[model samples]
Target: MYRREYKVSISNYPYCNKKVDVKKLEEELEQDSNEQKEAVVYIHIPFCAEICDFCIYCHEQVVNNDKIEKYTNALIREIQEYSRKSYVRSLSIKAIYFGGGTPSMLSVNQFDRILSVCKECLNLVSDVEISVEVNVLNATEKKIEQFKYSRVKRISVGIQTFSEKTRETLGLPLKQKDLLNFINMMGQYEFPVMAIDVMYGEPCQEKEEIIQDIEIASDLNISHISLYQLCVIRGTKLFSRMQQFDWVQPDESMLYAMFNVADDTLQKLGFYNTVIPEYSKYGKESVFWKDNFNPQLDRLSFGASAYGYLNGRTYQNVCNVDTYINYLQKFKVPLDSISEKVTVLQKLERDIILQSRTQVIDTKYLEDEYNELYEQMYKETLQEIIDQQLAYREKNLIKFTKPGMYMQEDIAVKFMKSILEGKSRLYKKMVIGNQKI
Candidate 1:
């Protein structure tokens, strides 16, 4: 039993802003490049036909073709500029992902040209896993054909729900019939994976509606199903509507019910839960996602509002489309922020926090690799979770149980909070003891 009251919010999460040092970033990228480490690349397509009120990511509604062409040219120039850098040229890119408002919005020619430019400039591996995000409305036959021709390994389709009520509530354009047709067409394709992205916890969503969405996805020959719980971002239009309508998040009890139902349903449908909210039928998780989240491999990001991590520094590109394009034209990195060099202690904490979210933290691995940063308080925190029966340890591995998964975010946060408090107290004691001496 834990006695403290704590809440997990997007702001308090560790991924928030940190310090930044541009020179250190340059040095780290250079060193990694020299070592010839495997890297991932992410390209952001910020142009969406219609803006979703619930979306928190940076995106602009497309108004003209000229702007798109200008952005595409700028993106190619940026990639070429990176190739000139010693570090970038040295990296063997393992994965490339095109994600955003809707990567499939681009014409086949545009997609091919961008891919060609990347291949010309970067040291892309032979079996690189290229993935593209597709809006259900945008997943035309021609686009699917383009993906096949481009050797794309996976396609992530955004079909948040199958319920007309929920879809209407979320202001989604198409109806259930449109998604059914899209699925039928996708079944004809030979893509390695076609993952469906679904969401739960909408104000108008019924339990049956969510279950129906999963059932529909399971019936299709889709390779994976990604089910996300809706988060009401603070500044988004959805959040404002919540206040006006007196809407609240589904209570914890209801949320847990939804999660368990989806987990159980997907598991029965032959989908392996690779990570919470992500299930794969073939048991192959996205290399880019794993690389990016694990924060060990270097990943480069291009285009507006794209975020990437390299050499322990996380960075985001400028969100404004015109500004990002202009800066690239001037031969500048369109970075909105480059986080400071992460301290070893922060790195250790991050590993524990992130691993705890979806998988076990291999205690033995941590001790062997990061013993210096693995302090007594950290170990004690791990012990507290075991003692509280929130997590179990076997040999060298520590993992949360099924019931514990629902509370995983809070568990990790509380443990981290306790470790930080202990550090504060110890520092205070050292100061007092020094005065006495």
Candidate 2:
């Protein structure tokens, strides 16, 4: 299962004795992977019309068609290579999520061919959830019309915020009229799930604006909403501006108010939090989120800077676009690194920590199966959090209190130990900072 991290450039062609090094991960997956045959596929489209100021995702501004054309070819080739694997071929796909930069940047024919190739080589369920993320700036009726006829069942729009002042502060190129028109135009189609992402707690944001955004989205007949708190990481334009202007963000109390307001509003609007930040009407839970993080399922990632957990291995692709294209074109695996998550303790940690975030941790099940491991790994920390009134246990599950939700990052970090591998191996830090949701 040894593989290059895509930053490695050693060979030209004949990249693998078996023809593709990326397949090595799959080949090894065939041998020792879990018995679950269902998988979720995530395809990353890393080109944006323009980069938002308050962002740090791996993306490049769309300058020309040449780069996109080359990247599409390489992406298709990467899919084909993975398709050839016995392990990949054996799985039944539960969902196919096309995330971005902005998946709408892809033309109809291009995405059509990509989906066609997937159909040609993979086993998709009769009612598989196929989702594509779009930017409001380019969520044209024509583009959405293409999706209506295609296999795409769920469409998520990255609207982030609808306030004109906040938009300007974030340097977002959005016009209110265009957004309204886009919404009206898109409303003509009856997609199963229509989602909008809303971010709050940004610098100079008002609580009422957050509530208004959610109210407007609900009024638009949108079926789903994802609420994310803005986090300005270093290297993003927002962080630079913050440093220059000493811009202050909303305090913890204000953020807490925003969360409660948004949460209460969505509930009153006939929506429930299917997961943290993701509110949905009945029967609209995102299949991608459900299956992608499921311990019983595999998540296979494609394209640049994608993170995946496949066959108990957590791997991330290199973020650089040219490096990704070159590695795949050269028949090499585009993995930045492949770390093992095959151990029992690692498996428990992955499942419990992720589960405890939005839902409850099934302590009864763990106590039944891994009593010793459970006591050693999480018992102390779990009890401490409960004593601290951050979390409480039900009959079998652990649920976070209101105070706990905001401090989940701290609680989760306490779960980390000087066990298998501190910062590497199976101990990779995932969302261990301030609660990402």
Candidate 3:
């Protein structure tokens, strides 16, 4: 909040050094701890027909039919294993998201088989938000029809940018004209939500390109838009080719301008920012995006490179397809890592961070619930941010200005660090206990 060099570190998931205790996870689920939450599922289909330069998410290109069949079988078996756990039986599934390299690439029969297992195993609640990610190339009418038959609530298509040059630069194989036609065709259907992804801050894209992307999406009558900024992550193909292309990353000022344009233009067009990147016409309830954005909701993930959150812990499956299949077939949970228990302070910070990403944080609840800690945060963290013109309080709600949204992560981190350093009265009272004061 003070714009110091200090960083705020909140534990979304804690790291444990010991070997993963698969049996321990099962035991906790079977015992039915008081903290058990209604869970959501994130199934990762890590196969793409081709890889994009900017994509750093764990994935592989479609290689063979046997591998796909093997992966699908393993994924089902993994879900069944969770079904056998006691806590899972008691919990009602809020949503199930099929995300990945290309979930829609699976055959219709494969979709039926996997969904049938979900019907048999999980307590899928009525009106569940069943969403699937589909690449435009693979978003066939047959597949869309299959999604409809399966009662999928939303379809996510990532159209990073409409610029043919940019798309080609990103390694997209489809022609720009064909891509537009495909999206239009999908929108004509009666799906509950047809969300499209528009990206900004790419290597050579200007602000006008971003505006055009938004304009095109709006024209298509797309129900939702996920506006994202391009990032050059380490270990990605983009990172490796940064020098070859002489990719000039946009400075903070340029990036902020792009964000403001998108935010203003989209809002005027009747789409509000539901989360950091997602803008929706029907508000927050339109899709299950909230479950992933809100820290309070527990998400259980499956398949290669999938991450899951339960109780106060987070875990991920193995990244390799072969390894994931082997682990599941051998009757072992394909857990690559499991986090340690999250702390109270970390939880508090996460709640504020996630909530404030889209809307203001209502301090009244924090004041009544956390009491002294809330007071301390107000004085040492929140007040300072207000003074810096980063955020403002409207009665009980503290909201970030447009400029502040760009630095949301950094600001959240600063506040958390202040709390950790005992700047709060609550911290001093509970931790130090009048040792010297």
Candidate 4:
């Protein structure tokens, strides 16, 4: 099985014609002295009982209880150190997402302690959405109860596929029975939101298997469904075994077919809001999907390998757990990488990209705000995409046609290329210095 990779050219597109003065924009934003913005915090708990072959997140396989304890303590120390330096004042936490390597692997008591620390460090809203990512292997009735008590209103469970063969290939823990039981338990708790993460295009997955997984998820009445396409990230076990496993990813035609099937099925079942490439649901109440396109809400991240966007800059913590812990021990911020401060123009572009992912972008507003960029880079490409039925354009809004949503990343790159090629003066050393974990 061979997977075909598609390349989209940005040079010839109508939207790729613009030149942006990156340096000028950056200086203007800095001179304005804008107040810092409130942000959502993402805490990455990178410990798992077993390493899934397809997982690329920074996580270590926990060998014993001692390692878990140490990791929890390190996380607390890191949080305290960051709070003191950042002086988290009245800035309310919009969302606190505990992601990666199975945060549910921590004991109930450990989770409580961590949540307690978070509350003390930041100003939290009454309806602040707190989410934890859990693997089915670690998710249990007891764990769900603990999460609810901890004020965690949302749960995202990893149930990549219902097929046993695919599970083996992905090296995921939990049997079909275990997964079903977990879903039933979650229903009992009726957590405000219950999301399941499923993967398509795995080595052992077929079109029919994908359909079956969606049907099962819908039957369970989960609040949201994140249907991800499998990608073999560099350095992952799956990437190494790609050849041996005869893994086959869907071709363009097959991918298009898969998307249609999912879109139709999920929508018919009332999961109409397409949150991202891999996510959709039936409601407006979810924090995960709420105001995702808003430019005002900044994203804050913690733990190894997590990234945060705050004020006008983006920062990433050290990716190595040991190094991150060591820095915390010395009472230092453990950030290892940072991107150039985000400019107002860049933020506008980000807002456009995020909105475009939902298959709807207000072209008029974008054109009015980024008139120069529209003339330079997006005009031809936008028309071309619309002509191809990949996107639909009205007076001021250009939205992805169903097919365009699957290739949103490619579209983004095309837009970014125009900026990258024309703006040599925009490039600068990152404020946090370049460090790879």
Candidate 5:
């Protein structure tokens, strides 16, 4: 078994202090003959009436109409600017996601205008999977109707928990009844697919509470669920309250219990394939699963503090509204950071990590496509994973046994240890700490 130790401080280097000139990056990517054309667009609408204490997303409290108008205009300008440079009008966009603060908070007119601008700029493919992330409180009949009229096919609603006590602790504004009513209305309309976002491991959450949340979701016949463990991101109200809370963040044992409960419960409810470590559903995993290769798909992000994956690289937009608006006003791309240009090695590692999390990795696929790289790492570290019983080779596939899945993060860290050390040999050795995945 893999040894469990105190969390090591894995340096977030390579990703730190990196910014890309959006125009330059796009040009470079466009010139790459090997670049794939399939694209996904993400629009960030960062206006929220109230910021959740646990939320670390780049968002602002918008209490005034003027600020909303200004933000919308800025978003439009950013879209227009990107369209001009990327020639997006001629490209087929496969998916468009409106996420953050509260995408549904926009007035119907504003939402329509934004969608219109996107259509004007990008050639949205017929049957493009359009999704909008909404806060339960902000969703209304008019908003849902407008979204349908705009051709939005998916709605990802944030309903972290159904327990009133947990909801209060989470500072969620809506009640369980309101959230259920919203889900019921969506079901009545057959809103293509409704995905519920749930959270676990909250400060005072009990096992029963989480199970109740799952039961409620399954009863509603929600098409998909994105279950996430509560994380203490650095600058959030929840982070500040972490100390005073009597509840303990689930330890490795507790996490295993939580994961098993959810997995078993969801499977019994006929939600089969685990899409991501935290996502699952009954039918074909959502549009996000297309192409099968996790990292190959493109993601375009909009809004304050939104991150997009495109052309084999990741870029994040400015997190502050004023900064975003200011940059757009100056006819510049509103970007804050461009994470490191992902190398082939990094891509392979990502695939390994993602596959390993599911308790399976296609060893033949790795051997066939990445023989040389796979051999090098297999010799160096893969043996250890096998020895620890975290992974085992089964014919052409390397699968993480049941016990292995619970400790997948630790295995990934072991792989990362070598890579990170090689990349920054002179830097101080930082260990991965007790942070939850």
Candidate 6:
């Protein structure tokens, strides 16, 4: 079972198993405020015009206008409350992200209203990169117009595969015209980063179809392409639907072949997305991606089921929409849980795994910051992966090979497995938060 979890998302590492108290966490934030010099704000909208079956994100169908309006009010209140805090008031906002069930579910006014409040209340920097995740319904001219002269610098859409049959299998709405028009209108605006998310390795999926999706999107003035591997989480509607398929589903080899094919296809078209799935044109990358790992920034996430990190502790908001609103109505914090303080070793481990997204690791920095022993053990682990042809060492740097890039999560797991097998000194200190920490 431990071996099976080798491919788990590194973002979820230093996993929390113990229950957390909301009031205690509130106090922790207050204490961390002095240390939190900068911030990245994430607003979560839980309503969607429609729900996709394969999505594991916290989301629900938009039942009515009343629910959305109320949720919007709660989000504004949350932001307002945070802005008044000593920590938030003292810090500068480096990035603002509107992620969601479908951020487009909010009216252009509602979206702008929230943005307006964030700008008015928070201490945002001049170059603060604001990003929003929109859905298919956001294809309207009205929606695209809302971004004109506004602060949102990045727009992300889930274009998961263009094949009609695959669309039905994944349970996305069938209207491609809306999506195309949305892209066309959005293309008119030159946001620094406009990305379309596409998935591969699905039932009855073909290379030709995936390639077409990439080409069409890239031609539509997309600045970035985020390639996702279709992993149907258990209990999702699509998870059950996939089991009903008659043909042999995608296996490891097929998944790798499809990914490599897409990589080649995108490279031919001038995208720089080699190391990780996020490929971009014009030397651009998402600001939120870099800030998420930065030790100096605290990501304060609002709304239902949003995750945030601050002062070495990661936390999440309530998943229940009504409950979230009720807590905020009384000016209370609606928290689900938070992890215990992250140790220095765990922090380095996290930095290693996530920096893999860039496909390079600086061993010199590790030795200098942590210790020579840690750097040595990490190199040993890299050597083990090198033996398997997933990564290689060049002087003081460790970099991922093509296959390693495709299987990033699994390689991160392999690092943990290596630590447990032979590097007990480091693993012990990592788990206990001792010695150097």
> Between the candidate structures 1 and 2, which one is better when assessed by TM-score?
2
Query: Which scores higher on TM-score, 3 or 5?
Result: 3
lDDT of 4 by residue, 1-437 (tens): 11233222111111211133223322332343235556677788999878888876688998787877877888898777556533344356788889888899989988888889989987777788899998777766788899988878888888888888888878776788888887887888878878888777777567887778888998887868876777676678887787776776667677667767877777777776555544555443456444434556666567887765555555567788888877777876766655455555565566666666567777777678778876666678678768877788665678777777676655654454424444442241111012211
| lDDT for position 183 in model 6 | 77
Q: How many clashing pairs does model 2 include?
A: 1
Residue 238's lDDT in candidate 3: 78
Clashing pairs in 5: 7-432, 7-433, 7-434, 8-431, 8-432, 8-433, 9-431, 42-300, 44-302, 44-303
Report the Cα lDDT for residue 320, model 6: 91
Q: Write the per-residue lDDT of candidate 3 for residues 17-61, one digit (tens) a residue.
A: 236564566667777555546767888998887788888677888
TM-scores for all predictions: 0.88, 0.88, 0.88, 0.84, 0.85, 0.88
**RMSD (Å) per prediction:** 6.0, 7.1, 6.0, 6.2, 4.1, 4.7
Model 2 misplaced stretches (Cα beyond 4 Å): 1-27, 30-36, 418-437
Residue-level lDDT for 132 in candidate 1: 92
Worst 10 residues of 5 by lDDT: 6-15
Instruction: List the global CA lDDT of all models.
Output: 0.74, 0.75, 0.74, 0.68, 0.69, 0.74
Evaluate candidate 1 by giving its C-alpha RMSD to the native, one decimal.
6.0
Lowest summed lDDT across 10 adjacent residues in model 3 is found at 1-10
| Candidate 2 lDDT | 0.75
Pairs of colliding residues, candidate 1: 19-340, 20-340
Candidate 1 global lDDT: 0.74
- lDDT by residue for model 5 (1-437), tens: 23333223221212322434455566754452443366677788888989999876668887777888888999999888767654344346787778788888888999899999988887677878888888777778889888888878788888988899988887777788888888888777677778888788787677778788888998997777776767666678777777667545766567657766876777787776453444556453566444223444565667777766655566667778998888888887887766556676766676676566456777777778778988886545777878877778888777776557556656666655434555442242332331111
- Name model 3 segments beyond 4 Å from true: 1-11, 14-23, 33-36, 283-285, 376-379, 415-437
